[model samples]
Target: MSIKGSLRSRSLTSTPSSILKRPKTLVHRLSEIRNKPTEVKFELTKQLKCIFDGYVQKTESKEYEKLVIMIRDAKLTDADISSILKEINECISILDQKFRLFVEAILSIEWTSRGSEVIEEYQVFIVNLLSAHTYHAKMVIDKLVKLFFPGPDDSDWEDGVPADEDCAKCINVHALFNSLLSEVPMCQAIFVSSLYSHFPYYNKSTHIHEYYLHNLLWILEYRPNLRPEILNLIFSKLIIMDVNAPREEIEKYLNADEEMFLMDEETKSIKSSTTAFTQVNRHALAHTLDVCLDKIFNYFVSECHDSQTKEIIWEKAKNLYLEMLPIFDRLILPTYDIHHVQFIMFMMTCFKTTITEGFLNYLWKKVCNLNVAPVLRQAAVNYIASLVARSNFVPLAMIKGTLQQLAEWIHSYISSQDGFEYVNSDIRSHSVFYAVCQALFYIVAFRYKDFVQSKKNIVFLQSLNMAKMVTSRLNPLRVCQHAVVQNFAAVTRKYQLAYCYSVIEHNSRNTLPVIYLDEKGTTVTSDNTLNTFFPFDPFILERSAKKIEPFYKEYQEADESAETVMEETSEVDDFLLNEFPNSSKNKTQKFSYGSSPGFKFK
Candidate 1:
């Protein structure tokens, strides 16, 4: 027989039951019924509605699982997937609240694991759903947000799939969001809301928060207009974690040299037994704060470097500083006892001198504004003193000018108190005054060499009338931090700028009254001594310190004979240990008076 006749005979002999049949996939079935008559389409829609209704009713049905499996396992072409999605988009009327499970099943598919073509098709389908039914937008956005981080049980691989595939998944998710944002501008609000709402709890695992923070920062690149909101949200969440993790605990754990203690089993046992539980949580939190701030600081650095030209980078850094000011005011300024979050501003200042000046002016304004809360004002001055003292970029002229301003304010405050017959010398009532004095003394102590560098500078420093301020009845020398007072006394006496050691001696012999009246008409006795609370003392976070340390100024030891310096430091330590006892042991820095424990010598 001829070849054609042989093929025809074989085709005729092949029976329906004898041939292997290909199972109909969900995509194929949908495409077939989509172009059929209206009656057939109605029946298909009715069946889907019934299946989803059963799902909602908690009825035992395999249809939902079967559909999910088909979506998950079927190796459909891009055209086929698009066809299926197009048909679903047409049936949005029937796919209402009742069909949520069906929509979720579509969303749950690991389309990111598929090819680029499949991801694009899946994105298109999502855009269509969001455009046609705005109500499901939250559900869609929520699912995408959840994919930002890995699950607790997830490993590097599971069932032959690399868990590192989350990188690809995150890329696809952000791409889908970009499309949604463009196609449906209104979705931006929902997207931002979703981001804020889905932020991992503060106590969540470190990696989880890191992942989410990274994605949020990625969003900032495309959504430049949303920079303020996104960054504000970040700072808000960061501060929450920051305030909860005590500064002392963070310093202890972060500065700990784990390798050094390896052979000391006794030390390990003591630490583990006394502080294992509390320390673990605190350490984890501090670590998270460190890492998150590192990421943000790195991002800031990258933004500045994006431009090759120094001028452009400087301009960008300036703009970024301006943008972050409101965020700092709204989120960081008023909040008290936050250890490290404010370094975001510090990092920005490192980019340019003008940026540093701008930040100082911002803080100084807050310090001088009477409308601002007293606590906030005190916090502002603390920041100014710390920044000026610790930033290497701040010019000496600016330091002198800042000192002059602080002196002027102190003198004005003392003059204002002259009108009252009975002066309330209480530190709490006069906290801002004492705070300003502390700031002046701190700046003078830290930068005394700058003032004495030339005759003109020395003359300018002496003209500030530090003598009258120290001798006033308010007694700032008595109220300021003892370490700061001692340091100031040593530096000023050496420079002959002002003599305060006598005042210091007097303060050492007597204790200030600690009783204060509360709003409830109750007399409360509390230790209201102003702490040496320098907010920008040191950036000790392991990861981001590289960016910060180069610009950071460490506390320099006074230029004096070794014996003299040691004698002074020893005297201060004895005084603090005698008076504060508990805090003095933990809070005081070695060799450096006025420096907190966070301070470290180069």
Candidate 2:
């Protein structure tokens, strides 16, 4: 065979080039048909329908990865999407303006996986599609505001902006948004409000947040009459939102609109500011509230270094708790369950409050019916315990059934270990023993102090009796971390299910793991998102850990009389150090200290 023929001698003649050639022809044919007004219209409409169908198919939970693959494999992925978008350079390219609106509306569909690359591709496609035909794309401006300026509709946000993001595409979306801002006053005003109402870069020293607020104020100041109706509608949606603590700076922006607009004596055609502001936009408020609560939840639970910000956030969180109290009664209590419990618990965590009275009452009523399993109850108990600390004064309204369910869990574990043949493992017996010890510790040291210390201390709650059997093997400290993950998987939630998954991922893996130690020695799980803030109060854990270094020389001692250190440090123990070893917990700076248990340290 000739050189070219020799290469095709085998049956593998239809190579990558052949496959590309076919699709290339299809694309070429599609391009050529663009010249014919009708054919271009027909194919464009057909392609849109295909994209929409693909989008709908991809939305089902089971189809996440498969849809991503399909989208990746599609002939129109990426650049092809770019090419189709390019054809739409002018708003008037289509036959009708109404038809033009439909093209922009379709961009709202989520076309890819939640991964950065996928979201970026989809965002680029939308940006290009919109940027190409600004005249017709204004319908999407508010929707774009919802997706990009602050974040996307789903849980993941712009993710990286103004930080590790140096890309031009990653340039502050405010600029592109501002270009169209002057064109659409109402949309511009709302977009400005959204950005203004969002969390600000207080730490970054860029009063960009205030800048947006000022712009909105400017618009209301300048455009008093042209479309007061549009402005009213925009500001109306903004006020009704259920946001968390608005920054201390919010007073200026919130008050500015009424202060500036109401002054216009000549704009009487518009309704007075008081009349127009009938109801607040709960959705916008919720979005704002959700973000702040998320930050608080991270500080309360994530393992970052302590900072002044954490303290400020904690107080802000307390106010949010009072605000969300009604939600617990109405939405969380009657409606939630074991399936939704993790999400509910996370929301509670985010809100940084104890389970409300009505919520616990509702949960208690629901749990007794056996619809929820003991594991879920155990999880609820764990979540409840997490909220209590040395600094936290917790009040348990009702502990009756909580104690009984806990005892029942212990009994089941004991029964699981009935056979005497097992030699090496005490998991079944150990689990029961630990549960008993924990309950006793709670009821003894904290609740029934008199009952535990008095002559009636024996109170021979045989279930609570297992503390003696378990304390030798397990410790309350280890239980706090290990039991939490196992238990939370059993319980409920109202918002952000992905948070639980993120918590689990951080706890179980070694992804820059940092465990924040609370006053009670319980470890709060942390994640990558939380690295932004110092996760814990430095005064508590950081101070304690810091003080341990000075006493390292005293760690090794011959004072058997003084050695009161527990024989076991951890259930999963490594050999005790004879000299202080480098701690990987901190990135640098090792302490020179002799190794021995300093009884005072514990």
Candidate 3:
């Protein structure tokens, strides 16, 4: 008879002595388990542990997966599974070793392809592993990997450990990981999926950040069989799980790894040796960025509930944006899709804290489009204008038009609760309408070139600059561009005021149009000096070119006026006749601006 059948028969029996008691049953079982001597108990425990492990392995095995599929098809919900485990607790201790054998047997099967609930057998062990805050999940994984997939000291699975010492070394991590990677795609997919999904739902208990250089190097460089799409997926996960991880972690994983080209460290493994910079492949990087933007925008617009989460997302995303600055800074006119315009905007919003150099130029060439939604296009334009203002660069006509577009978009998205300026102080901060004063300075100064000939555009630029200049809310009537006090006696020239204001901002918050150049000869800047944030007015830069004259004469006309005058005087009457009709031989006159803004004079 089945256990249930037996329980029913006992319940129907008339004898009161047959009535069962609940409390002592567990106590009696405990006594029975402990009654044996030390040696016998140890041996028994060991044997049963092996059996339990086997059971887990069996559940994981492909050959017996028919059993697993049958269980899955049964679709016992999580509640049913929990009840089943709870009821079997008494039976487990007595058959501990036997159960382990079953567990390991199940574990041996590949679970990667199976979806979420495939966590069945391993969940108990995983809970044990995490009990005391398993330092980091990675450490546990490393230990577990070593236990079943045993490997020795100094044996790197990635680069073949030096063959000379190899036979003595431990099993290669690559061997197990390679097998697991192939055997359990869905397992990996779930691991990554859960990890990536957990960012916003953060509890110190859940944010088990254990991944280090070893795993990252494999995911990034090797694993060719992995769908390359997984990379895009991984990047999206990082963006979504967005947390303000230490900047050092970013360096630790990607930059500190000597094997990765993104790092500056010297080569370690000769087989994978490449420059640190070369480690980040542009195509791969672009693909990752493309997906990250998509995920972030989607989450922000759809799922993100509060500004706090959005800020956290932005903080995490900002680091990624900074990492990509090298690529974006290098390319001016990269061929891009129209969809990318929105993505660029997302990046600007997230990383607006650090508006990269050449970024505006990049957007102008790639994302600016009138063919799209006017408001969307305007957002692009306004963003460029804001960058122009925030940066010390001279904002040209195209850039000014962009700022106008942003202004229009601001009006359009005003009703939007897309986690920006809908409630709190965001508008007071990152929004384009309330951008920094410097962005306007560049716009006004640079726009003169394009608008000097057009009265209407010039008026528009002046109006925008004037609006930007009214920097205070309380005193909107006043234009206080000069009132924001500046410190650091670096560059004293008005021309360099903007550079001085920006170069050292995070530490010293001075956002004025000023540069405090070092006292002239004491600290002169070199031609090669790198000031990524400082903008050079092209007209101002052109002055450094040396003037060259055509050499059509037998001897070049005397460069020195003294020699020329001497030659003319020596020629006596020939020069006296009104310079012989003003030197048919040659002519020269000094040029000057003489109070004109154009600085052009004859």
Index of the highest-TM-score prediction = 1
Give each model's whole-structure lDDT.
0.73, 0.34, 0.33
Writing each residue's lDDT as its tens digit, candidate 3 over 1-602 gives: 99999998887774565455334688788888788543311011223334344556675343234333433334444444444344334235443333333334333433332333433433443433233222333433443343322123433332221233332221233444444445444445444443334322211111122122123324433464342334344433343222222212223333233432232224332222134433322222322333333433443332223355544454444544454444333331131111122233333433333344345655544333445443333334344543443233333544555556544443333335344433332222223333223234334443333454577665664454333223223121111122121211111112222222222222133223322345564544332111112111111101110110110001112123312122344433232222112223433222111111111111
TM-score winner between candidates 1 and 3: 1
**How large an RMSD does model 1 have?**
12.2
Worst 10 residues of 2 by lDDT: 530-539
Cα RMSD of all models vs. native, in order, equals: 12.2, 23.4, 23.0
Give the clash count for each candidate: 0, 24, 66
What TM-score against the true fold does each predicted structure earn?
A: 0.78, 0.28, 0.28
The alpha-carbon deviation from the true structure for residue 169 of candidate 2, after best TM-score superposition, in angstroms, is 27
Per-residue lDDT of candidate 1, residues 104-205 (tens digit): 878876677777877887898889788877888899999888888776675523222234566677888888888899999999999899999999887776
| Residue 587 alpha-carbon offset, candidate 3, angstroms | 58
